[model samples]
Target: MTRYLEGQTAIVTGGMRGIGLGIARRLHSAGAQIVIWDLAVDGWDSVANGFEPVMRQAVNVASLASVEAGFKEVVAQQGRVDILVNNAGINGPVTPCWEYPPAAWDQVIAIDLTGVFYCCRTVIPHMRERGYGRIVNVASMAGKDGVQYISGYSAAKAGVIAFTKAAAKELAQDGVLLNCIAPAMVETGLMAEMTPEHIAASKAKIPMGRFLQIEEIANMVTWIAGPECSFTTGFVFDLSGGRATY
Candidate 1:
């Protein structure tokens, strides 16, 4: 059987756990070499099984220096990066916009929005040089609908979606495709931070009346990361389970 992603190298930020882990597993199953860039180094060993000898890098996505150093190491080890999944993010504090903390806001923006930019900015040149690349940024439905009490997270994810569009246009002619996925609530560690009331409210909003499974998101990402996804750059793929109106 010919693997769809054989011989490709992929970098998945926050790949140590949760949705990112699911993505890494799927891509690896498709035969891509996995490099997980995350702050949690200990979990890599468990997730590394069955992948093509996964590379683990302890990276703080919020810092450009950290991202640069991590990517440099990735290049040193793998020699190339064919796909990038910008999946690192934090929900910050769940509070009204007026009550949101400045520090918390900055933290969310740094990790969820600016971090994606940093990864793209660092890897895009390499992708352009190679004349091939697939970049997937993970945004959220909150970005589109502006969920109440999570202003910081919503705004940051919105920025990610916007950035994906702008960057995709800039690189459209360069053979490097960039797109983002806006998913509704998923059952991940991030949900642990939300109050039960908040979780229930989010579920009620989804027409499907359920949280998305990680594998569903992974399957969508797998397709988007493959060659068959050609000609679909600069767009947002909705994974909202009927919650997204646009």
Candidate 2:
């Protein structure tokens, strides 16, 4: 079978583990040269998956300087970036909006919202210069529905969704398609940060009555990052397991 993404280069933020790693694996399997960008590179060498990133760089996506340096390195090594999956995020503290810590809220916004902006700001020029690119921002259903007690995470994700749409429109004719996915609860390391009550409440809201599998998310991302995802820009793909009313 011909690999659909042959010779392409993909950068997956937070790719050392969780949903990001799953996306990296799927893209690598589809023939994209993968680069894992995260704050650490530990545990990746021990992952059982046969797939390995062509390169791994420690990057703090929330810092524009760090993002710029990381992308500079990627371009120097790979010559070009064909796809970017902005999947790095934190769930932040689960608390009522009024009672949420300022520091915690800022942290979530910095990583989950500002980080995506930084990555896109740095990568778009490269993609525009090359006349091709695909960007998938991993948002959440919480962004749309506004989960109670997780105001920081929900607000940041909502920003991501809005940013994706605006950026897609800006790059519409530039051959860079930008989109976002709003997935319901997915069982990932991030879940450990959530309260048991929050987790239970989230699952109960899902019509599917279960958390999403990593592979299911990876499958959607694989297609979105490929050339076949043409004609769909500035759109939000829902992976809410029937819980999304909109």
Candidate 3:
């Protein structure tokens, strides 16, 4: 039939690097036009050219106006967004509950959890109106398994999963599907921010004995965002390399 994403448009937050960038590349390969909203700006990355009219906007996900204005800009430039990938997120310091910084905790919640909320709240209406749209949210295995050192990040991602389920139920009747993916530890520069010991500990838990590749997660996102993703809403797809059971 029609090449799945032919003539379709997409918005990928944090699409400049890592898993988000990978998803942008995947969707582009499938024939979708893309607009990237992210804070990272490096001129050398080849993937930046993958998206047509790739607009580079540095945004703090916590700000409502930024979300609103950004989506508005996407629509203004691209006409309508057929797919929305909520992938911009963060992991605060790996500290015990008592040691967690209040400000840092807020930052994590804002970027990881509330960022998804802001995007969903604004973009879902367009999908609901179009009666044909797909939204893929990128959560983490920690959202399901709750790692020991990142209580705040875990709690925020847990909210993301719950929100995905609830929103899926509400939007399914409108022909809009929403799904969440939980990846364990994907190999990306993000890991560089973590301590060596922490990364080693995370790798030790995965039965696969190594970190996940960014492209692996991107494949899942593309599958879920495509036209055939019908009949599956509010479901969480696991990509933790067998680290999760639920």
Q: Largest lDDT belongs to which candidate?
A: 2
Error of 1 at 242 (Å): 0.8
**lDDT per residue as tens, model 2, 66-172:** 99999999999889999999999999998889999999999999999999999999999999999999999999998999999999999999999999999999999
Q: Stretches of candidate 2 above 4 Å error? A: none
Model 1: what TM-score? 0.96
Residue by residue across 132-152, what tens digits does model 3's lDDT show? 889999998889888888899
lDDT of 1 by residue, 1-246 (tens): 357999899999998888998999889888899999888777445534445445888999989999999999989988999999999998888877999999999999999999999999999999999999999999999998899999999999999999999999999999999999999999999987889989999999988888999999999998999999999998999998898888
TM-score (all chains, Cα) for each model: 0.96, 0.98, 0.94
Q: Which stretches of candidate 1 lie over 4 Å from their true place?
A: 47-53
The lDDT-based order of candidates, best leading, equals 2, 1, 3
Q: Give candidates' CA RMSD values in order.
A: 1.4, 1.1, 1.9
Least well predicted 10-residue stretch by lDDT in candidate 2: 41-50
Residue 67's lDDT in candidate 1: 95
Question: What's the count of clashing pairs in each model shown?
Answer: 0, 0, 0
